[model samples]
Target chain A: MSFDVDIEVRRGDRTISCAFKSPRGITVLFGPSGAGKTSVLEALAGIVKPERGHIAVAGRTLFDADQGIDLAPEKRGCGYVFQDSRLFPHRSVRANLLYGWRLQPAERRLIAPELAIGFLGIGHLLDRMPRSLSGGEAQRVAIGRALLSGPQFILMDEPLASLDASRRAEILTLIERIRDELGLPIAYVSHERGEVDRLADTIVPIGLPD
Target chain B: MILSEVEWQIVALSLKVSAVAIFGALPISFVLAWVLARKHFAGKVLLDALVHLPLVVPPVVTGWLLLIVFGNNGPAGRWLEQTFGLQFMFRWTGAALAAAIMALPLMVRAMRLSIEAVDRKLEIAARTLGAGPWRTFFEITLPLAFPGVLAGMVLGFARSIGEFGATITFVSNIPGETRTLPLAIYAALQMPGNEADATRLAVVSVVLSLLALIVSETLARRSMRERGGHVL
Candidate 1:
């Protein structure tokens, strides 16, 4: 299995529990709004700490409460594409895409920047500020940025949730390409039935399955 | 030509004192502001209150405290002088130090608000993309909070320009060395025939404060515009 995760995270008064193991390709955390699906992605990215249990990805133990092992977010080698496209508003698209790429050591750089930029098709939009881009363009740039981060795995939190039908289809195709071509393990968060049906290699229901 | 050389010297010294004070206080204020804005630890309340002591207590009390700590024979004063040949007693640098301390609370408050206003989610995103804490702060948090930082500088500079009680008590009003605009104004007022001189210095002080605010606001707006038009 590429991912073996059984974690309980506390959010306010409510506690969210999730357990899943997935083989390579996309593992979809399917659920409705406020189901704590996004929280799962954050935990995988090491941005949110799980209260208990363990997180093992790609033969590496990221977190194990019993073993007293917890890694920092930056050391986890994750490319997290946030739902809002969280591009640095102060930087150009080119700089945002290269922010992590430049930080990775030459030997650690797994994906070439040119290839990721070509795959995401954000070449023409490179010089533009994030605020000026359309939602779809921003997301594509965000995806490109994540891909070029030289990460071991990618966690996407509902990247298509805010897109139009056409844009959604486009990003869906992009996600499929990333899974099949890049061969990178993906933990994708989504509440869409059609999306899960179309893209999930392994479905981990976050809440009651609809 | 219109003002005497001594009056001009006072204006220049006032500017120099405020400039040094703002520059000296900025990094410390930023670090304190970031911690206050982001961290939760034991004694945080005490730290916050201590930081604002200059703002709440009477200026004369603050001045007396500075004198006690930074006086020639005080522990800190002796050690600094022994270690680095640094002297703060009865000098312009001592006046600058007093102004900086008096300005620190306002500077920290403005910067803390700005840092708090930064989207924490973006910082998280930056971390997930392989940035360490320092890298993320410099690359993302600082740039986004630049406008607030500028505003804080102006607020601190304006306060430093008007610093009187603390500067007078800590450094003493030595002409050409420690006397600033407000001190010059007071000196002129002490003499019966020098109302015109005091008025000129007071007018200059007002103009300087106004200029600092206008320049700070313009720079802040420009920075915000450059970062995509979300003016603070």
Candidate 2:
């Protein structure tokens, strides 16, 4: 699916602007810290509102400042995997994965819970609480949760930045596997050159506002 | 240790009043606490102060206000009596109303603190998962804040049982009707040569309060354990 993004967002005192189209594949937003990478992802997920612009993914308009049409995050159909896995501490891993899946309408559901759990290789940890999982395990569950929500595309904000080297390697391989196997378009945010080289099919560079 | 019928009646009446008050006020308290904790609007400060007004104001004054609003000739009382034939004056229901109003601040305070303590990120996550705002609150916010809710209920129950000044002022000290434990204790103390009866009732109150506290703590701990041992 193609993604079109042309937006200007004001954060604090700075206005960050970007206009780009991403062809189906992994499009990495590469930038240094404080360069509004996360902000862009947040805006796409409808978590943050842009001062001006329109976002259309797969030819469906998610936000349009001119038209006063801004869907809430839940209606955006864009899965988001945060850097820190924000799993509900009260729920088991399986429950967390199903949290989004169960809320989806029958006609809108594209991914099954079993498929997501199997794809992420987290079936064994289904009953375990989020706090008991390691960083890698937790991230895997977070990804599975987002996937099971039947998103049109996925936005991952430096999802590997918090893991150790070995865990990072594991997650990196999983991300590539997800991209190749699922064939889902991904808008990834990262600063690591190695990660970009290994995963990015298109690169959108962001810089600090002058 | 055979207790007189009057003592038994007081204990039963106190329990009934407190139970009714706490349970009846629970839904209202939850909504008020959630609004106080999550929503920001005009007159928010005024609403908050009004909710907590009973906590700071003397109980007698609160009871007096209730009487003014709910008395036979009062506007609300007269309306209710005419429309539904409902009467709160000189009745157990009136005592329960007084207890509920008096306990509301404690209930709201506990639930609000708990609701505030819940991580907003979880709610956001729920939203992303397709849960609407109301569903998110019931499934995520309410369960996470369960411990606080339980504690709040216990505190309200304790306060309701001990409410005397308001109950007396609004409903009067009618035997078998409005004379809850605290009011009974006061009566016992007032009557000459009833020191023993007063001491017995006070002991019962202390015991009930302690039991409520113990139950509250136990429930809180169990809820924490169920939620993966995270402390509130």
Candidate 3:
């Protein structure tokens, strides 16, 4: 199993829960709008404090209610691709890609900067600031930045939801390549059934709790 | 009009005092601004009000308050002098300290506005990509907030250069020591036939202020362009 997670998160008056032990490759979290799908990823990434439960990524305990062990988000080793592509606007594309990679010990860097940039097809944007890029280009850089950081897994939160269909397809293909070639586990969030069908090795349904 | 040696010395002293006050307060202002911008606590409102007190209260009152705390006979003052061999009584350093206190409000406000404008989600994203809290702040948060920091420094400089009430009350108008531009202007105006000296000094003050504002605006625009941030 790539992920073994059973968690509950409280937002306002509502509580959201998900319990899933996902297989290798991508685990699709399928739900409608406001279904708290992103909250589940937040829990897995250690961004949201779970009300109670355990999150184990590849058998490493990220959080456990009974054991009282909760890792900081930085130590959780998650490469989160936010819905809005949170690139460091102050940085050039190449600098953004290297931000985390440089922080990692040379021995801990699993992916080469060149390889990640090449894979994401962002080589041409190395010197350009983020604002000059189109939405699709920016998203690609965001992904590459996370990938180059050498995270143990990736959490993608509706990465294609903002793009046009054609741009969506282009990124979808690139994501598929990341899944097949990089061999990193991914927990992908999406409401579209087509995305779930195309990406899920295991489908985890997330929604507001009763 | 060309400045005499004494006039030049006065200008230099004023610049030095203002520079020390602003630069000395920069890091402390950043921490206070970050706390006020990002933290939550029961006494948050009280802290905010306290930070702004120097701005609201009469500068002479602030100087009096400083005297109570940092006077040579006072606890902090005695400890600082005994431990570090430093004294702020009747010295230019005292003037700098007064100016710093007076300038602090504008500095913190400018920095807080910039920090509040930073998209906090980016910090979260940085953490998810393996950046620890310090790295995320220095790299992501600070860079995005640089323009505001620069603006704050300039505002503090202006305020410090013009700080008279607190400085005079705290350090006294000692020539070649605490007699900065404002104090010098006051001294010039006190004597008969010294109106020319006062006018020239006033002109220098205006030119310095104009230069600071121009430099601040140019740097801010450049930093904003480099950030190119639409998220802000």
Clashes of each: 0, 0, 0
lDDT of 1 by residue, A1-210 (tens): 789999998876678899999989999998889888987888888878999999999999999999999999999999898899999889999999998899899987877878888888888998988999999999999999998888899999999977899999999999999888888899999888998999899999888433
Task: Label model 1 with its docking quality class.
Answer: medium
| Order of candidate numbers by DockQ, starting with the best | 3, 1, 2
Model 2: chain B TM-score vs. truth? Answer: 0.95
Ranking by TM-score: 3, 2, 1
Reference-based TM-score of each model: 0.93, 0.95, 0.95
Pairs of residues at least 3 apart in sequence or in different chains that clash in candidate 1: none
TM-score of chain B of 1: 0.95
lDDT of 1 by residue, B1-232 (tens): 2778888999999999999999999999999999999999999999999999999899999888888898999888888889999889999989999999999999999899889989888888899889999999888998888888888999999999999999999999999999999998898899899998888888899999999989988888788878852323
* TM-scores (chain A) of the candidates: 0.96, 0.96, 0.97
lDDT of each: 0.90, 0.89, 0.90
Candidate 1 chain B lowest-lDDT run of ten: B223-232
Local accuracy of candidate 3 as per-residue lDDT tens digits, A9-103: 88778888789998799999998889999989999998989999999998899999999999999998888998999988888889888987987
Tens-place lDDT digits, model 2, residues B29-143: 9999999999999999999999999999999999999999999989999999999998999999999999999999999999999989998878877777777788988889888
For candidate 3, the docking band is high
Compared with the real two-chain complex, what DockQ does model 1 have?
Answer: 0.77
Q: Candidate 1: where are CA atoms >4 Å away?
A: A208-210, B73-75, B78-85, B229-232
Give lDDT tens digits, candidate 2, residues A53-146.
9999888899999999999988888788998898998899988988888888878777678887777789999999999999899999999999
